[model samples]
Target: MSEKSTVPGQFTLVLHSHLPWLAHHGRWPVGEEWLYQSWAATYLPVAKVLRNLAAEGRSHLLSLGITPVLAAQLDDPHCLSGMHHWLGNWKLRADEASMAGNTALGAHEHRLATEALDDFETRWRHGSSPVWRELIDAEAIELLGGPLAHPFQPLLDERLRTYQLHEGLADAQHRVGHTPAGIWAPECGFTPGMEKNYDAAGISHFMCDGPALRGDTSLGRPVWDSDTVVFGRDLHVSYRVWSPKSGYPGQPYYRDFHHYDHASGLKPARVTGKTVAGPDKAPYDPELAAAAIERDVADFVATVRERLFSESERIGRPALVVAAFDTELFGHWWHEGPQWLDQVLRALPEAGVTVGTLADARDRGYVGERVELADSSWGSGKDWRVWAGDQVADLVDLNTDIVRLALDTLDKMRADQDGLRDPVADQLLRETILTISSDWAFMVSKDSAAGYARDRAHEHAHAVREIASAISGGQLAKAQRLAAGWAAADGLFPALDARRLGPALGGNDESGGGSLRNHAGPRGRRMDAEGPR
Candidate 1:
């Protein structure tokens, strides 16, 4: 018998980039500081990696999901101004270190900080608003859009979910000049009926975890109830680079994430070894870490090549090995992550393995059969416990009650008024949507920044409760007063209109599902009117 010919293999690398709506929110354990840090460490560095590869005539495929909320923040004038100031401050700090430190250390610090600042200024001169446009112009990346402000979809009231999804897509298109073909599903939180809404939005595909795939994972394929394809991340391939417990980043030579210098509040240590405690970790050295990155890149390439070859031979078709990760992980968590990415993208093609985007894989006919996906997330243990854990049970209850009350209030107001002319009611509606953001509850549950998270959740909840009470008791003046106070603090999504949610709040249609359709008009009016109240 003649030996069978094996099919070629393929893989996609997807990175999801997001930060909460924090343009006005300032620096702290959780706020705009997080945004600046990720920008300096991950976004800018990742952009350089992609740009370099593209310049070299290498086609390295990667999918990047930039949430609409994040896009807004990136494009915000205030954020752009703040980022410029922040970059200049970084350089100043480096100069200070150089003046106080050993000459070699000083020189290295100043050089890196100066180079980073120069790159940030050159690449983002169009201000924060045009970063997405620049990336699209280069065609070095594929953009993945998501619901406005990253709400947990399954738990949201259907009307609000529809409004968020619809408005988010519109916002992305307005900003990026193209309707997105895929969504990141806000924390990879997917429900049974979401695909129908996705199909209505003209999205061709979305991503979920590997376990969401039917049978054994091989390639992305369409899900049932809609024609939009779902690509499942191959956890086996991804975890090799960065897992919770083990990954290349956790190696002895890599920079330690936890052992930061108390005075500077900057990480200043290397892992040294698995047994090394936080206090005892060795000081970080960029030169040593660079060497480690080289070794890890080689190892990663070997693993991908082996998996692709073996799987192709077994299946007699092209095999995909997706490696999905959070964009924050690159330089924020693992200081060497950006360098490792640069090395891996440069080396993968030489290993005879293809590097391609999710869209490319789909276009080349790599997708397989469709299946009904389960409710899933990429959180702790691949479950929703992180968002709905015991620590946040009360928060979940509070949010649920407030959302129902807001929806009921909205219904009553719409029924009572001739049109959506009530500014008081409009403010109430905006507060309601802000209160319903899944981010607050998630932060509370994770204890990542528990105090701020609890405060924000309660703040929005109080606004909703008070507004509903005032409206119900016929205290229109008091309701208006309270709306003004809350608006001053949380004035985002100002264009939110309660009228567009309509009567079918939680109802789903027989096929796919009912979504809030855009009302025809100027873009701003449509966005404001169609978004969730």
Candidate 2:
């Protein structure tokens, strides 16, 4: 028998890698800075850990979902070059910090910056496609695909949603040369009957927040009599590492993410205490951190071990425990995240725990009783409030208006042109996707960079309004010019076609023969924008 058959239960870690399209949009504080910082502090180290493990003959290590938008940016010429410059600038900042008499901060940053720059120069200089593709070929990970711009599916009209799903998978296939049978549905957002959509897209499994399962998150369940399985984030096991009040990252010895040495743009302090003010936090000590990481890893391994045995006995069978988190959390938010990741993976298997991706759980017969799932997301309050709340009511309404307008206009323009794809229509679709991204509304509801989120939403909306009006008024030349201008920034997924939003794509819509424009749903209309400032 395989190790999987002998183990008590299976644990799958799902790390969602996503960021809204940030290239050529903004740089400092929110835009490309978010990308570069995460790239330096998170992506580099995390990829290194995985690569190291794969070299050690580890297969089926974990499930990683790289959003189509983020994947595009990772491989984009502009982002690749920008990331190089950012890495160099980081080294310069470290030098400046040292020259200004902060020896510890400068030395630490210099080492980190040098390593990151070397990683980029050697492996990432060409772009991240080859990096991800290498892992995919190694079979060390199960790649989960997602929508092009990470829209909340429950809020999208069937026409656009179907199109977005297809195009997003296509983009992923183009990037990594593998079309995933699974998806990390943006925000784990789900509505009833979405299985048909997944089925049509050739997806075998997808994710959801734990509450969506209501009980027994130890197995993947087929939703509503469909073969498409749904795996839920086992929050009880997941929150142990990053929970607000008691996660491992909160321990005082870990590095503080919020306390930065402004002089050199480096974080120089440890999280001396959770409630302790930033200025009073103790200086970071690597020795303390090494001790903390070892303890955390062992504790996490024990936690999973306990949960697995408890769940299997409770359910009367071997169980499946899925711990899902944002990929950025490991390094960007929790500075020692990459180290913890490497150690945890090694520890779990050594503890006689079975480790595998969600796909392994499915194939190994970790299926449970089929049940109807309810609408849910891994958002604030565990519901749609964060994206559809009263605070973002305007965004919701605007999203509805713009989605309907963009689709209808594209449809009309296609009809006039004998069903050919129009450049103007494509750009309108791109802006619409960006405008309705869940990030914007999320930032607004959380009051983190609400203004930037609002501005991006309006900017895309303005572009949509402009392109749509131009087309409607028969100003094809002006509309073409505007599309070209917008493409300079909003261009991603060049293969994106406005003509693909067909009702005939087949997703169990009663109105399959009719346009998939009936977007009337439970909450307010749908919309999105970006930022935390």
Candidate 3:
């Protein structure tokens, strides 16, 4: 981390990279499309930036969180072949565009598609393990992990949460060759005693929203009474680049993510105006976008410099300013985001603003006093509303019902079979995990692909119900076929075992400490597993 002897403070850029399991699921409008688009647009370019900077002798560039489920897809055999085909199709589309006389769009897309294909072939064809492993080995970025499937821990059963987190950490270890001491806690959703869980799991630091600190995000705080540090995002700085109302991506020069040239499957328009119809938008110009990237990079560097100086003065010492964003927001949503990132990272060091990862900020003692964190998330209201709000009340009930039923069936079978390896129970557990994912509730609440989200949740729940029934009815052959079919579709974590979800390990009785199974509350909701316990 480069710094002036009397610098204002350390600045950390945290990018949370995550997506739900989308392997053998649908493709065109929702499932694998999301994965492949992000892989090509965001992952490839951002990784290239990090690798280039590492070659330039840069280390501790930023902190990146890749959830284990997304990691699984990035390394899955099915997804790799699918992505290869996607890239090939991208180039073919560009060729078609050229034949159709949109020469400029065709030329630009051809270059991008060819580069992406080469990068994928050379580095990513095998799997994402080597690609990320190289960066991890070089110390270019600190990798922060999260629970498998990105479950909303605050709403999960204690035993399930513990299993998910530990397994999530182990999965990352399996991929990158080291267990992460830090995590981007799913949804930033935290309960009070969850810090103790982090401590038990050996997680040293985690992140939360700015409001979790009551707006005091100048430094990382020790949560309650644990050494597990909680870093709250400096939303004032983060929102300056990408927020609900305004951000750099809204600039007229950037390529518009919404508008598409349907025939070629390429984005050919700039964000000419906020309310501009797709047909009215101007043609995207790479040169103009490059100029915008430079302008935004300068603005961001200046923002950090000003925030650091002002925060240092107010706090009476050098303070920490963390700007965290969804990694997908970069190249996927904002076409020039990778370029902007490259510039801002290099420019910050030159501007006398110290840049470092979350680990650097913590190890170098950019920490503050201990404070008790309340129920919070980086969601709509900085609370549990997004995942546990009224709009998702049905999902909450469905999750509760399936969890209890699956646990009951598994518990019965495990005791009867003396802890035998039951693939049916393993598939049962897998479906439940998939069913309870936070993405389903989030998408429904935000009205972004709500239909697909709801269908996925119900589909998994139905799987659990039918498999458990098959077992209880003594239909062993039918159960085997069902579990095998589901595993063929929802197959990501190869090491997940049904036997490992042994009791709560350590948690309140409501979440599997004892025999308190029927946890359905008013309107069939699960009351006990929520955050404020």
Candidate 4:
């Protein structure tokens, strides 16, 4: 522990990184652009920070939740090549900005773009698995896995939900050469008895929002009599650094995320004030931002120390404070976010506050008493409404039909001894997963890129319906053609073997804290028995 004699608890930083399947989809403003920007800005810089600390012997610095969907993009050859090109284009755009007389902003952009390009060419040219694997191998970070696509588990069919989780874990193993012991449940969404599924898949721990535990989130609790521990994110600490209304990122000094310079495609302004318009915002200065990062880092460290000490006293035991957020929040949304994160990681340990991964905190005996958590998520209202409410009822109905159709089609095919190895069946499953991604419902509810998100969901759903219809009607040619077309356009998860979906139906017990009899399915590695309660 890096804690001082006076510091009485632990702090774990958990970041959930995810993006929907964007490869070969649209580019600028929506699809691959989102992936490329996060890679160059967030992933590369954050990896460098961790690698630097790891070299200096910092262990378990944080828990990084890279959902399988994002991992697939990071390791995809097509995406890697595209990202390389994007970086080169970035540097060129910076040069263009310099030629246009915005010397200061251009020079900054040029330097950032050049360094990112150099970093990408030298190390990331091989893909990101190796970079992340280095951190994991060095024990500098614990990688958390999630479903194949980041589907809202609570709303998904139990059979498909288990399939997504198992396959997602397997995908992580295949890419990074290690199995994750924990997961960031998509949206931190969990239904009662879901822990049994986690137990069945050999997952040891997972995260939920603090409110889900009724605000008593000082320690990890065993859920539903299962040994799979669930840690709740401490919003008190998390919101101090970044939240909807208040946070360091919203400070006047940081670069404005929404105000863009359309000509050069750069953010040239600072967040002058909350009500400031894009055109009226002041110019950004690195020096101003650097000073703010220092101040913010010190403030955050003090806040964490105070919280940890108070919680330790109240709980009568060493408490654990888990602050979790979306990885994209750093760099992508707030340009100075990655720098602040680097400083925060360094400052906390120096300030006598223990900084470690969730696994480290748990292993140090931060476990709490068992509790039956209510059905909940970290979304608005701390419930499933964001994903399954009236606002997105169409998406909800579409997902329900997609799940039923796929299962019925698969069951019929298997009844005639046609197993899941068929290409049509594999592609059908892929479409189903794409349609149910939590991102769609989130986008619709927030009205941020809602049209694109809705269209994407419907497109995948239509594909599933068409493919399943072809399979059920015995139109093998039509089914294969439709599946092949989809495989060409929206294909992700190269390791997504449809056979891992298990016994399509009747597998979920649904009545108690027990999972399907066969969880790993054919062609999948069998999971170990659950830990004792």
Compare the candidates by lDDT and give the number of the best one.
Answer: 3
lDDT, candidate 1, 1-533, per-residue tens = 12112325776789998877666555776777888888888887887787787777665358888887777667666777878888787777666655665445446556767877898778775654366565666777778888877887766667778888887877777876866787788877776788888888788888888876742557777878678888888777898998878899889888787786554445667899888888888877788888888888989888887778776776678888888898989988888898898888877766667778887878887788778876667765455665666666666667667766777787788778888466677677666666656677677766678787777777777878888899999998998888887766555555556666657433343211322122112211111244511
Alpha-carbon deviation at 455 in model 4, angstroms: 0.7
The runs of at least 3 residues in candidate 1 whose Cα sits more than 4 Å from the true structure, single-residue gaps closed, are 1-7, 58-60, 102-106, 418-429, 469-489, 493-496, 506-533
* TM-score on alpha carbons, each prediction: 0.87, 0.94, 0.95, 0.94
Local accuracy of candidate 2 as per-residue lDDT tens digits, 1-533: 36534568799999999998889888878899999999998889999999999999998999999999999988899999999999999999999988998888789889989999999999998888889999989999999999899998887777777888999999988888999999999988887778899998999999998988885699999999788999999988899997767898889999999998877789889999878999999998888999999998988888888899899999999999999999999899999999999999988888888899989999999998897987678887667777777788788878877877776787677777877777788899899999999999999988998998998999999999999999899898999999999999988889988777673334554333222132322343222223110
**Cα-based RMSD of the predictions, in order?**
7.3, 4.4, 2.8, 6.0
Evaluated at residue 25, the lDDT of candidate 2 is 81
Estimate candidate 4's alpha-carbon lDDT, on a 0 to 1 scale. Answer: 0.86
Give the clash count for model 1.
4
* Model 4: per-residue Cα lDDT at residue 203: 91
| Candidate lDDT (C-alpha), each | 0.73, 0.86, 0.89, 0.86
After superposing candidate 2, which stretches have Cα over 4 Å from the reference?
1-7, 503-533
Q: Which residue pairs clash within candidate 4?
A: none
Which candidate model has the greater lDDT, 3 or 4? 3
Highest TM-score: give the candidate number: 3
